[model samples]
Target: MKIQEKDGTIVDVFAIYWLENETLFLGLPKNYGGLISYKEKNVHVIDSTLNGEFNYFSTHINGIYHWALIKEALLDDIIERDEVAYNRFVEILKAEGRIDPDFY
Candidate 1:
């Protein structure tokens, strides 16, 4: 699925693997047919670190982490961390107020 950020930036444009647990893993194409690029590349050069590294970093990282959290939720078979992201999924379900008996 293609996801556009709130500001309309293309966060991810590649292949993905979605797990039953809701975690989405991004796969980078292999180089030379067997070499996987494991190390990260430099995106910027800063004399000082960005404020709240993970918080700022999370904006970019969240796309990857969100899917991972969903995977964890699915594996644990519970909807917990969805709360972190403004509890959107739960709020929608609560407002709708009906659990599909067939789904569970």
Candidate 2:
């Protein structure tokens, strides 16, 4: 998946994580390296494209740390601690149907 910032910057999205409270988190790497959210419609799905039979979703980036609205915690420490585990967790979410397959 691709995330297009308001400044027209596009970045690759590694995975999507869904919290127990229904908060959606995107596994992406920014300068600080953490997750992003789609609350408030600031971030939203724009389009889906096919590449070699693989479908990927494109989302527009408008807000930065919307996840903070749901919980007060630092994810950078957890994310930076073990990237492999983080990525694997995302894969689990996808496999468990927490992440929409259309965004693959």
Candidate 3:
């Protein structure tokens, strides 16, 4: 269930705090809080200070989660690691009649 981040480090899919099925902000995980490492030279080195620096997503204007979606890179990792959840998401998209089969 490990996937590489945009920064090139691998992380477990479940290690992220995804807010699935919640009435608000459903499916987005807490984003990094200024602790993201850019251009990591050593992939083997794990940062001990990463845990307490996560920040939950928010918006200046409140709105329903009709557009709560993960980035395509994360989606690719989830699809590779978790079939059940990926299938459920596809089903939901199908139900909405908005899924582009080719894109998914």
Every candidate's lDDT: 0.25, 0.41, 0.33
The residue pairs in collision within model 2 are: none
State which candidate, 2 or 3, has the greater lDDT: 2
| TM-score of candidate 1 to 2 decimals | 0.19
Candidate 2's C-alpha runs over 4 A off are 17-25, 44-104
lDDT of 2 by residue, 4-94 (tens): 6666655444334434444343534344334554332345444333111222233342223323212323344435545554455445445
lDDT: the better of candidates 1 and 3: 3
TM-scores of the candidates in the order shown:
0.19, 0.32, 0.25
Weakest 10 consecutive residues, lDDT, candidate 3? Answer: 28-37
Best by lDDT: 2
lDDT per residue for candidate 1 within 1-104, as digits (tens), equals 23333344322112122333343422212111110112112111111121111111132223332232253343122222222332332333234432222211
